[model samples]
Target: MTKIIKSGSGKELADARGRLAPFLRDTLVGLNYAYYEPPGAQMLHNNAIFVRSHDYSEALSTEGEQPWKTPRLVSSGGTHLAGSLADLPYALAWVEQDFIVPESVQSLIWEDLVPSLLTGAVLPRWWRVTGNELHAVTLYQRAGEELLTASAKDEKLRQMVIDILSDRMLPQRSGRLEKALRAGRLDQVFPQIMPADTFYLASEFRRRFPNDAEHWGPAGKELDDLCHRFASEVSPERLSQDFGVPHPALAHSYSRELLNVKPFPTFQDYSSRLLAESWDSNNLYWARLTDEMGYPPVMLNRLVPQLTRRMVEKLFATNLDDWPAILRAMQETGEEFRLGKTASLPKSEATPGP
Candidate 1:
């Protein structure tokens, strides 16, 4: 078994610093290493990471003009890892010098994330804006260059769903997950982790009453909200599961807190899955599902938005087709959804799949 070193243990903070110091040996001489932890958004508060230099106190210093925009140092040691930090950079300077970004990759430093990193907001997850890249903020995996950012995870999840709904047999990617999604069963997805078939009833309740905030609360808002809760960091079971708890939204929020959101100057720093990272760039990540076999992107769009919306409304508001009429209407729209509530005769009279 491979052993890993942790940056923050109950062990003395000085010992933690001592353990981390050797990793910075090759970095600049005067460069100091700063470990960061954010003030979490626990009721009436906000979660944030602020950076300025290789020191935490200065990066978050209110004594200066604007503490919120301060530029803070990226921590060197991996949280639960144990090994050579030899390949890791000592400070933000090393992060800049060693940034590994792809030539074709685009940095999405919207108005919110970039300026914060410039002054001192050290975010640590998929969308975290850093000096040169929006990295996963990982440590143990970087020396080997196998970082799987959250955007990559979301893309994979989307692809997995499409693959399951494709209906036609193809190369098997995740057979179990595909099967579960096809049958609309979440219990099979993680039976061991989640012992009970809890969400099945909950999800049905939300679908039936999408706006029943009084009882369902946030889960009642949208199906996606329910999915975000139920479908947390599932692919990377161990690492992500550890971070998945508390709630769905909080699952990957602290990926950076676990490691540094380093700048990968090139694509080589990313995992092989980075090739699929182009999903966001394309307007239709689900285009293949729609174009090839005729499954529209989940979001309503100009191409055939009304058709999908009408189909959805009919599925809920209207009765099941007693004749071939509704079947023809569904066929015309080209959606993969089933008429679950379609009316049928008794078992003796009605023959299925006819």
Candidate 2:
């Protein structure tokens, strides 16, 4: 029987480690682990043992000293573990205990476009994000092809991102919008790409709290409050049915544009076309692409996630650009590491969201 990894199989991880460890040593942990490299190799072996703890809000936790003897152990608290006293930066890996810790770590690693990433692992989001500035003078460019019609972008996949920030629940192209994102002068290089409303809201959010230097408070929390009200007033089905533009705040307005799909699309036809769009833009044309595809918007936003990711990945393959360096601006401390540039993104993993 084939052992599944993402769903978190302790046996499969143990078995793979046993089978692959001899020649590679713990390098097999790279198959399913999160490793970190601090400044000047601050931590031993420069790899972190990331476990999915119930209360690890410190997102980047600093575990002081670890027992290298414990190859893979699950604590009573449910956090998974994988580390070693390899004596060198010989291994940087981790595996899931009860949760898919390795998977999450891998996701972040792949998002960056360093030379070490597998030959094709660097993505447009990593490149375009610099121009768009997803925030912090850095971009998290997770986009599909330029050929991707606006409507072809999958809003369902986009909306799946958790609002960890709590405010501005909508994801914006990181612009040097507010004073806090980076030096105010960065605006000379990165033109503002966030929607005008989004920019205004983000600015308003930052203006309220002068003391929070990073603008980590997420502004006035208008997006959160609006979402809270939306939750109270609207049923999820109605929301998904009515406003399917990926983000909730844009849903109501977005639905209006979809309502006007030229020639009007039947439900099945609309659904099929929606599954094809790979990148999203707030522009009205994207919402109307199904109409252009002969699949008008008479139906609602009924996207299928599994099919969407596959289609988007195909789109991602066609047009790839190399990422630019941003070493001068950001001071990203702790747990910073990159995989081999020739290393490929792990296949067979399901990313339901883009």
Candidate 3:
């Protein structure tokens, strides 16, 4: 197993720095090492390397006639170097010259920090608006590039970033996120995405990667509101391909509901059989049995919507002829109702109506 190096902010950074100090200082000084740390989020809070910089101090200086945005740094070390810098290229040039500080050995900033910092996710501890619009644009570009790079490399990380980007709805979402989505790395996240974002992320995934149904198809299966939407949204071919005939939830729910009746043992047997078979035959057998129960048309008319509303509408609208049994059942129900009404009327009224 690759060792999980604690490399980010807080005690993790301190611990890592302490463990590899002199070697780290040597590495940083000569720039002669080929060290590539694992790709993960780095903590910039309490970053020792950036806190001692002149730009960082100026950004934090309360006495200065500058526009620093809060929350202000109260503790000893907490500032993002890439974000805090007034100008990155110029600032890095200066930082290289000033790298002879004592903290270089103590802090031992990782080379991986370069790529991780480029992710641009770490907000500055404090920043001043210096009328240079390029500062903000540069930060965005740097962050976007790293996010895209990181996302392309790891599928789960890509999904996490996609979830974050799903906040604004697609097209309206950040171009960085859009680029991430287009990278086409879709996988289920551990602990799953939050309930609110699941459907949105699933939706965006489907809209963007229509052919990659397997990725987004089974998402939001646990949510009641999204169940019908999931079924209706995907194309029939993709639905069949990805979800194995609509979805197991819809099938299992239908079987559970339909088979729950008197003649308890038979109900159980039928349910088990349908569930076990999990084929179109099960749907057909149930449809026939429901029709035989003296309400074929109304049964499907009601039950289809319960399974999925829009799908049923599309089926009935476009493929009515395909379900002759349902049509016959509906006609028979209407005829039965009319005849029963006539039979219940008084003889004089019946004769007059005749």
List TM-score per model, in order: 0.18, 0.18, 0.16
For candidate 3, what is the TM-score?
0.16
Q: Model 3, range 1-354, lDDT digits (tens) per residue?
A: 014263365667667768777665544532311121111212212243433331334443645535333112233344434123222322232233222222112332222222212111111111221211212112222233344345666676577555654553334334544453555433422112221233233334434554543322111222223334454433323222211222122233211111111110113323422222222212222222233333323333233212221111122212311222222233333334335432322112222110
TM-score (C-alpha) between model 1 and the true structure: 0.18
Q: Give the residue spans of candidate 2 off by over 4 A.
A: 1-228, 231-354
Report lDDT (CA) for all predictions: 0.25, 0.24, 0.29
**Clash number by candidate, in order:** 25, 25, 1
Residue 104, candidate 3: C-alpha displacement in angstroms: 20
**Per-residue CA lDDT of candidate 2, range 10-128, in tens?**
88778776776553633554432323221122222233433222122222244654445324434544443444433111122122111112211222212212111111111111211
Flag the better candidate by lDDT, 2 or 3: 3
Quantify how close model 2 is to the true structure by its C-alpha RMSD in Å: 21.0
lDDT of 2: 0.24
Name the better of 1 and 3 by lDDT: 3
Winner on TM-score between 2 and 3 is 2
